[model samples]
Target chain A: MKWKEKDAAMYLAEKEYVDTAVIPLMPVTAGKDMQDVVKSGEFIRYFTEYLERQYAGRVYLFPAFTYIKTKQVPEEQLKHWQELLREEGFNHFLFITSDASWRRTSADSFGELFWIPAFSVENMEVQELAKTMEQQVQQLVPLMMDMWQSEEK
Target chain B: MSEKNHRVSRRQFLTYTLTGVGGFMAAGMLAPMVRMALDPALEASGGAEFVSVGLSEDDLSEEPQRVDFNVEIVDGWYTSEQSRSAWVFLYEGEILALSPTCTHLGCTVNFGTNEEYPDQFFCPCHFGRFERDGTNIPGTPPTRPLDVYDVEVRDGMIYLGQINQRG
Candidate 1:
């Protein structure tokens, strides 16, 4: 399920079944020269959508949390989001993005942050683009499995 | 000329006009209900929709192979293409295509992923597991068996229909 009206209605009806929340942490730069930053946003969207489809009924794909790239990581805001989602009955939270700066931020305050290396998708062929996305999904699948298993214990 | 030939009584004219107008109004009100009652008959039967899985007869093995395909899904007025994945295999000379979605909470299951249970389907979520034939292991979270897709072989290619729940 996604953060759209239709999916949210269904999620509310079956809130017990959907236990995981996947949020895309996107960084937006306010300059025209930051094409790579913009591309990273597109890549994150594509990647999160794949995750949502793979685990459609169990996972809720929340809207992207966009922040200014030049500023420090929003640790306070992220902690608030974690508390809010936990109150809403989401037992698992997976934050995915291609922004490398998040690695410096402490993961103790928020959910597991998966910081994938950014890549430029401009001028890439369709087949190559798909292969790149597939590789990222493969990497994330085992991590997700581990998270679910830990929760079961 | 007879005066009665061209003359209509007021009562007669009123009755004729009212009947015609009432019939039209009644038909208009009943049209939607009539169509709704017959809608199922007008809809194409579930068997008619067979999506190609792009796998041939030769591709099947004793082991389950993951196959992905896209199908056109219609929900009310919205139409979209959704990619679906299934685990396909040949068992006892019959082509079997099982939906990877675990019967317990709808998580995608993996074939032979558990080291302890090498031949069974394992769900990463909640540690749910199913037997080789998609039956939920006893005392597991899933009370029902994993769904199997209706299969058809045409011109050496395999096409899958709707996912059917097992008894």
Candidate 2:
């Protein structure tokens, strides 16, 4: 399910089946790295959208948690979001981002932080973008399965 | 002589010209209104069309494989391309394509993924299982069989159309 009104109704009706909450963490910066920030945000948006489609039954894709790029990770705000989602009955939390700063910081406490190297997709054709994301999603599926498996134990 | 014999009175000429011009003006004004009223009917009904999945007969085997394809979707005035996937394999010497969407909660099901659910499509969401032929296993979340795509083979290439619910 997605962060849409129709999907919200379905999610409420079948909350048990939809246990995973996916949030794309995007950084907004007006610095010298503005282009890079936009590129990574674009990639993360598309990546999470595809991931939600693949696992729509189980994943409730939340709107991206956007924050200003900073040296220190916003640990408190991130934890608050996680707590709210957990209280809302989402058992698994997956946070995907293309920002390297997230990987540098120990943000695993927030949730499963999925950090991918940012790739420029401004010039990529639609067909090529789909192929690239499909390949990456193939690798991501196993990671999610592992998360689900480990939690079961 | 004939023109004089069939002489048209000034009043008759005026009436005839007025009726002729008025009829032409009325038709011109109503033509656009009629077309606008029937515009919806004139439009081609929105139906799913066959799209090539970039797979040939040689790619199929007994084991089902995921095939991805791009479809052009038009919603209102916006046009976009969407990527969709299906599981394709050879079933009883015939090409078979099944939609990956699980009937229970719309999760993508994979074939031969879990060791416990071997030889079946397994939904990771709720452990829903379907048989090789996409029949929902008893006690699974799915209440019905997996949807079957209308398959067409042209030039040895596989093209899939709209999905039909397996009754």
Candidate 3:
């Protein structure tokens, strides 16, 4: 079954659908405002709708298994923070949620524009969030499949 | 002018027309409310609402069985819960729903037996034990029998309701 940004309650019906591909829309920030970390709320709201409208009959929509970050920590730094997750096998590859106020990205160098950066004069944009999401899905899918198969065995 | 007696004053005609229109509007407004009130009852009795798996009349065998069943709960949501492990034992061609709820403290009873207890449901909580027929052993912490599911057969299908305890 597949899940798009549609509706949260559709997870029940989506699980039954046999032939559907889960599509998590690429993230885009609401606007160019630097006032606060681009509102995760608005971004996810649209993203959620995008999934539902795009994949209505083709597949069912599962709730967004989302992760938000208040600051764009470069991919290098994130590795260290989640080192224990891999060591202890906490990465079940299931849907996950994060309360970080920042949008996600794959920047190796987290300059002021890296994210709602740490104590600086920079506000993140949609392009960067989308780019990060693109990379994350690609890298995470294989890891997720590995976890799923192990459970069956 | 021969039908003049059948005619009425302008105000009287206006009142009659308004009343007829008002009655039609009132019926239209109440039509939706009437349908909404009765639609749920209609869906409840419909046979397609929830299909039951046949389990009540079948003879229970002394074996572990996993019964799978699915139900369409809401219009868009199809919910299903299965017995990961269900124990079945024969009782004169009547199949019993042997739930794993422990009688002592409602903990799950384990069918895995030790050498000491050859055939009994062992409750880890308070060291309670029950016989195959679900009778609590004397000197055990359990004081009641395990709950049983209300079994109903409709067209060779078994529908189970709230679990009732054997008094």
Candidate 4:
């Protein structure tokens, strides 16, 4: 996860590109109960405040990133996620796919993952997607990078 | 001091005195009412909803890279925008959302994949990583990690919120 974030930022920096950072639509949630979305909202809020403060106003967490849209991943996978968070570090994005094998079950059924969605239609729909992303970059670059006075890591 | 002013007699004096008292009474009663009316307006300016990226727990790979999400945004009256975004992270069944927007130049980071080297996120902009934060690699153009996002699970559904710019 650390590598990915850094890698992603590098790619953008080289390309001199910036885009809107979207919170992926939630298809499946990770929780012990059936209705724990309120907690989820809080989590997003906390992160947003953190980003805004840390960046000192160069960017904003777009509103859509915090919406609970659906429930797609099975229960077992969600449990695996909780366990994985402790083991592997995922900064704060919900991820799943048929490839990320897990050893649990949801609704008395065991199944492999079907997909891990992170690729930006980079292949699914490149031209339109790139245009949309560029617009956001133009808008947020000025907003996210006010940290000019601060030194780099 | 015309006809109307001249008519201000004894009865009128008392009426004016009572009017002054009544004005004070009305203001006393209206202050809280005004606050209540504007309270919601003040609050509405804050925000609405979170950004939930639709990724399954299993699909999160151990490799760190950029992720994406698309959603509908409603602003003010009838205004709205369909937004697409990307973040960086390495997944191990955990949810980690990172902002892909480079803090330096404005450009979308393009993911460069090769059979020899592991997949890499490259920004064509001005080579700035670590603008957010996740995992760092040597020799990368990005000086900062992709921004981190706060994630939570509820009722078997996921909810995302604000981009973590410095995480």
Docking class of 3: incorrect
Q: Write the per-residue lDDT of candidate 4 for residues B101-148, one digit (tens) a residue.
A: 544433445455322333555553334333223443446544456665
Q: Give candidate 2 misplaced runs (Cα > 4 Å).
A: A104-106, B1-46, B57-62
Q: Which candidate is the best by DockQ?
A: 2
Q: Which of 1 and 4 is the better model by TM-score?
A: 1
lDDT of 1: 0.83
- B6 in model 1: Cα distance from truth in Å? 36
- DockQ rank order: 2, 1, 4, 3
lDDT tens per residue, model 1, B1-167: 77577588778899999999999999999999999999989998874489888899998998999987777778789986667789999888899899999887677888998899999998866568998889999887788999999999999999999999986
TM-score of each: 0.75, 0.83, 0.37, 0.36
Q: Candidate 1: lDDT of A66?
A: 80
DockQ-wise, the better of 1 and 4 is 1
Choose the strongest candidate by TM-score.
Answer: 2
Off by over 4 Å in 1: A4-19, A29-35, A56-58, A88-91, A120-132, A149-153, B1-43, B75-79
Error of 3 at A97 (Å): 22
Cα lDDT tens digits for candidate 2, A17-40 = 888899888999996989889999
Worst 10 residues of 2 chain A by lDDT: A101-110
Locate the minimum summed-lDDT window of 10 residues in model 4 chain A. Answer: A107-116
- DockQ scores for all predicted structures: 0.30, 0.67, 0.02, 0.03
Q: Cα deviation of A95 in candidate 1 (Å)?
A: 1.6
